[model samples]
Target: MGSLHPAEKPKAIDLSHHLNNLSRSRHPSPLKDILKYMVQPGMISLAGGLPHPSLFPFESLHTRAYAPDSNLAPGETKHGVVDIHIPQTSASTSNIAIALQYGPGTGCSPNLVSFLREFTARVMQPAYADYEILIHSGNTDGWNKIVNLLCEFGDYILVEAHTYPSAQALWAPMGCKGAPIAMDGDGLLVEDLRRVLANWETDHPGVRRPKLLYVVPVGQNPTGSTMTFERKQAVYALCVEYDIIICEDDPYYFLQLPAYAPPASRKQESQQDEQALLASLVPSFLNLDYQGRVIRLETFSKTLGPGNRLGYFVCNPIFAERLLRATEVTTQTPSGWSQAILAELLSAWGQSGYLTWLRNLRDSYAIRRDWMCDLLAERFDLENSPVPTEGVLAFAKGHGSRADRKQLFSFVQPKAGMFLWLKLNLIGNPEYERLRAAAGPNVEAQWNEAFWMQMIEAKVLLTPGSYYTPWEGRDPSPNRRKEEGVTYFRLTFAFESHEEMRLGIDRMARTFELSWNLVA
Candidate 1:
């Protein structure tokens, strides 16, 4: 060795761009906070919003090729690996080990993508399997990447009138604006969106048009309304006209009401009663996209486990490439372990069988929905609340819309997504009805404070309604929306068990009843 040359140590790298303490990912796990305060040993928790682990395919995965060759039989651990056994073929073990390694920027696992592509094609579009796909940490991760790739501060983005809260928050801080498109039973109103965009363009010609449109197509969050095929087409047509991109956020696509009967009846099977078949569905935006403008996000949180935080997005290469670059720069890659585990579960389910499994999940949720609705009926006299329309949400515009907005601060109908989006009466509402119903005008704010305070005093936690609105004016506070007149509160039913769900409803019912007495 000339000059006793040795391997040089790596020089210290300068911390320039990485020095900031900002986070792309959402911290202060909201779900964790709810669980910590609300969970009691014997408390029947309708508060639970996560999937039931009992339903996961742990055994199915272990029995099939999901595992390595080693642990096929009991009490056998090949190579001292705790979980995997290698009796059938050690070569399989090597493949599994490779999956464990850090994958590409998009993802290491293509198995899940392959299955998902096939699934989307057979069910959504026949030609979609040709489109590009990318794995993400979850829907939020995919959303963040898309925002980074396309949006700049004060950029206009179209969202639903009632949409996911986290998405609303993420967009606002980035200096982007969220414009809401009205939604009805069908889904996002294309005609309304067309009018809004046209008006905005005319009013603010100097500003750029909305860069992207965000939506939750299947079992929509907060609203629980799924888009029909015709509506989806109309929306897509509008997007094409406006030349805007579509971000399809569909975490609950597979979590339909458990009442859908397979298409066997189309081939002339025995006629089943309507009561016998109650599965619900409609096509997804990604499935309907012919122009490759849709980036569809799929998540396992609703159907599988939320903690897994595993999801994938499929879009055209133009956006996909940018998104993957963002992923590389941000998260680098989704959890390799989660990708492999899900791939195994998906493989075991097989293609057709997976649909059947999803059907069963629908049934379970349908039962829960029915149970919850019955509870509400018995308690609140929902005739007063908004009627249950779609999947998980119930929207009843009490006294608010017609008269005083404050009077509108009535109870919300049990809607979809394990949440009840409550509409409260605030001073902003010109239609404040609390005055006529009771003493004077001050009753509106008093009632609002009283309701939330009681819920907190009762040890129940819920997300406030204002959290969902985009770029609305607000006062200074830790939760800025509180100071604003966003009188919306979301209560979930997904995580809580049946008994706990009942109890939660009972508690809510009691709270409402007490408030009602005060107003009377």
Candidate 2:
């Protein structure tokens, strides 16, 4: 597909018309008007029922350096740690006074907010002129806020066929329905999106057309598929054509891994070449969004740590201001202590230093990815090379000979993020075929349950593909169940140690071998 020109970009959706009743009724907090002055040089604020900073007992706060030189691996340079101390004084910017006291509902400390704005401007270079930023707790909170802000009850949310389960769980409870868009190896398939939107009324008779699209464009949660630049352009074009709002929840944007290299070949590549590869990452949706329709959710969860609960949203001022209003009534703000600590850390690191830290983080995860991939390759009978096929498991299912039944498993070695999405060869399982033949109402669930049980018995656990399946209650056919039958398991190499990763794969391979009766 050709690149979309400024004139060619779709018209922006009117966000005001899409907002729910509660969101539409929401007005700015009166206390926020007064709280804005609390930071002024001589302002004595008795507004907002804020707690007195003097009443707090603690005089200071301290913490050890996070990841000091002592913790560095051999030959690795030390990324400076964040040793912090916040005095009780109100005079100092890095003090506990403002942090301990009630502040703006926007979750982030003023300094942290400034830092993130600069960071976003420098890195993302969003094309929209009216874009604004709002701090939130994390992507999870961000997703919920967006759902509440945009979706009315019974509204359809378009998502990649394989998507973040937690996001679905949040939307499902709100009476929102998921409309699953088909995906290729690159993530959400544009053609499927076009087809679904074009035929919405006929295919989904009486159901509302989806106005919102939720996607994890970088290292998509369970699938670990990164949308290519061309694919993203096509997707954006479709979203414009369909008049859909895009919610880009990308927590793993910076954790993108370098292109995979075989174990033997990696040793041959020079360090310069590897660094060059790392620098060439795919552009974010925010970068490509010309119309102010894309709202991006970014987080420090994957990079800094989830415990911080710090993230922010980037969107046009219209949506951002509304999201801030949502925050005022809900979380009120993210933990002040987290924002304060992160502010100090970011100020110390600066932009270049921060980029270095991200590089170190990406390199570390890449090592883990390589370790896990190598173990899976050794333990499972698999195809190492990418096969030319459409959708997941195209290579194995399409080209395999009758004798190739012994090749029982395949995976798209992730180019980014922590997950390796394993497509199990359930077609070779005698029980699976039997269950398919019977085709009872609960047969698909039973097959998945049995398969899950076997894996648990083997002492390895993985997220079932069904958890990521979009629930379309309106569909009358049995095709959804059949689609769920294409067995997939998401494995993460993030938390596990090198040895533990090896052990997990060993157990997974043993379970597959036993189930398929392919033991040598």
Candidate 3:
């Protein structure tokens, strides 16, 4: 576990080969380029479609904001108000006049960008010095840009066997195919990645090797798997070897939680400092990206609010310039209102406050994580055990064929993010094969759909794991693919109260019991 502190300046690597024809043909906006002259001393600007702030309908914007440490357990949440009054005239980036006007595609303005760049430098400590940031709508928007930058029609993109479905869906419509790499409880399996990359020509014949890899390294969307530092090192090495650009779509990086233990075995708490907090997190890919191939998609959606629709790319300045060109054409900027509010709010919080806010969020999510797992364990008679992978814990119901067994489900307790990836022993249900054959070619999915509908009938809604499958992954856990007789469902502990969670889990358990005919 080496420190992520910067050891060297980043060296430029030519990744232009990875760019698609469409992106290569793009040029920066001519009008946006002219804004450079608009800032000169007392220049009368008639350059762009500039709306005079005087004609703007609103005089100011105001909202009550949350405190940095809001929502801590056993304490009342504190709040504050951010007021942006559009003064008659002011040149400050944080002023309401500038906030309400046209903004750069880099962000709505330099206000949020400056705050974020400082925060990234201080907290994330990207190992590369030449890295740049470009704000987009969020991870979804950020991902779309990456796909456009690299993936041409019919290009294959590497992805974890299970990934954020939307990321896969974004490129699938472009006629590109998904090259799924195997994964486990610790996220991407390096050997499996190497296996795919090393054997690409043998497998695909004339198809080009995938030039881009999309992964959710923290609290994997469907699987709730977190990558360890060693795992990231290995993955990064493979990307470098294979000459692939890594699109690290890590919205949940700050949601990293401590290992779960049953209440009886749970340890007491200790005071956590900023350094300790940073140390606890698995370093971002940017930390290991000396050659600048990693485009780490950082977002304020999870950290702040999703409605803000703001996120940014941290990568080599070369790739960033191309992405900036793309942005200059499409989503020229995020909502100006969003950037201003966030800029004000974050400035109020400062870097220390931001970390404190993140700490509070991490703790809150961890509590909910505990609540979900604890309820499941209580209802299922689960046996908790340490999995072979680092940062992974699992729960399993009895595997025996005893007639008294009522239901069966297995899951990996999440180490980060909002999901609990669970596998119900649908094979434990008597009609497994009947349902399997009924679905024909799409057996796993249709079979899982039957179970999902059963849960819906029972008034509990959990996402079918099939939705998150990058390809046709038989099992959510790559290590357990050989072990069949199970179907996957993804549940989130991020929303709803403890009582609601319990009620849902109870209903889920009862549904399984009835399906197994263990209930009269």
Flag regions of model 1 displaced more than 4 Å: 1-96, 126-129, 258-280, 384-416, 424-449, 472-486, 518-520
Question: Which digits, one per residue and each the tens of the lDDT, describe model 1 over residues 287-325?
Answer: 456566677877787766788888887776655655665
User: Candidate 2: which stretches are off by over 4 Å?
Assistant: 1-14, 44-47, 66-82, 90-92, 268-279, 384-386, 389-404, 437-439, 474-481
Instruction: Give the number of the best model, judged by TM-score.
Output: 3
Candidate 1 lowest-lDDT run of ten: 11-20
Compared with the true structure, what per-residue lDDT tens digits does model 3 show for residues 1-520?
A: 1134444565557778888899999987898877677878998877778888788777666577777766665234565544444343456646566767776678656767888888778777776677787888998999999999988998888888777888877877787777777778889899988988898888778978888998999999899999998999999988998898999999999999999888889885674788899989998887777788889899889889899998899888778999999998898878877877788788877888889889888988888899998887786666544555523322224523455553466677789999988766666467677866566665666667877899899999999877876653233223324435656788999888889989998898787776676664
| Model 1: residue 44 alpha-carbon error in angstroms | 59
lDDT of 2 by residue, 1-520 (tens): 0134334435434566667787888999887777777768988766568777788887888875554222223246665557777788745456788777777877537788888888876677676655777888988989999998989887888988888888888877777778888776678888888888998898778978888999998888898888998888888888878778899888888888787776878863333333453357687887778788899999999878899998999997778888988888788888888888888778767776676667667777888888887786566444544553222232222234445654455578787888878666566577877887887766657777888899898889998877887866655224342554466778998888888888888887677666666565
Best by lDDT: 3
Q: What lDDT score goes with residue 491 in model 2?
A: 91
- Compared with the true structure, all predictions reach lDDT values of 0.58, 0.75, 0.79
The alpha-carbon lDDT assigned to residue 28 of candidate 1 equals: 40
Each candidate's root-mean-square deviation in Å? 15.9, 4.1, 3.4
